[model samples]
Target: MKIYFANGLFALADRMFNEVVVDKIRKMDSNIEVYLPQENGDINDKMNYADSIKIAQEDNKELLSSDLIVAILDGDTMDDGVASEIGLAYGKEIPIIGVYTDLRQHGVENPEKLKAVGSIGENPFAYINNYTIGLIKMNGIVVNNIDSMLAEIRKYL
Candidate 1:
């Protein structure tokens, strides 16, 4: 199966995760294909951030065409661009798997008071913009480990 990997690109961990996941998937099935954005090069110095977004938009189109999307929704919060990719994947009716390394699922930070008035389930001081919201709404599974992520993919593959 063809897979589109989504994650924070600004961090080295993102690259590590992609490489690890791709290697794992390929080991599972050498015929499988993975798609990722081209590494930023001298072009980034030539254009502004907006141009980089334009490049990402085109890359996302390709991402959406994949059979499934494996997204890294880790860190303090889900990356805005990654969220947009999830939205686009949902719009295309493609299956998604959300991978998160952060363990704030219990809503620990800002426990003083809730920011979003009408919230429930540890919402009083929810941190990280409730990363699970989009994953749940998109009918995607939230996995905290690479093994689980690969297992989930195997189900679809």
Candidate 2:
């Protein structure tokens, strides 16, 4: 199964998803392919926001070609570009498996919730809830770990 990863690109969280989680998934199944935006996408050094969006568009196109998407929704809020990629996957009818490590960190018990002291005025729970609605509204699956995400993909594959 081809899995497109949607997550932050300029932080340690992104590295964790790519280095540890994605690698673990690859090791679990040799046939599974993971797609991510190329490095140098950050606007911190040379690239600007527009350049980053351009890169995201290219990557999203590649992701749209994949069989499914496994997104990392660990940040306080969903990545804007990642949300756009999710939209593309939705448009293509590709199954999405959202992987969130911050599930319990924000007082969230399940995929549908909000925190007591919400951060960003919305909190991580809101992010999960929005993504869950988007995924379920499109008949996609949601998971909180790399293993579970891979397992869900396995069911369809």
55 Cα displacement, candidate 1 (Å)? 1.3
> In candidate 1, which residue pairs get closer than 3 Å at backbone N, Cα or C atoms, i.e. clash?
114-124
**23-119 per-residue lDDT for model 1 (tens digits):** 7887888767877653434222334444666767666667867998887777667778778788778777888888766654444444354364356
Worst 10 residues of 1 by lDDT: 38-47
Over 4 Å off in model 1, which ranges? 38-53, 106-137
Error of 2 at 37 (Å): 1.7
Residue pairs whose backbone atoms clash in candidate 2: none
Candidate 2 lDDT tens digits, 7-124:
7777765766576767776777778887755343443244455565666666866787898787766677777767777777887788878776664555546444444445556544
Candidate models: Cα lDDT each: 0.70, 0.67
Candidate of highest lDDT: 1
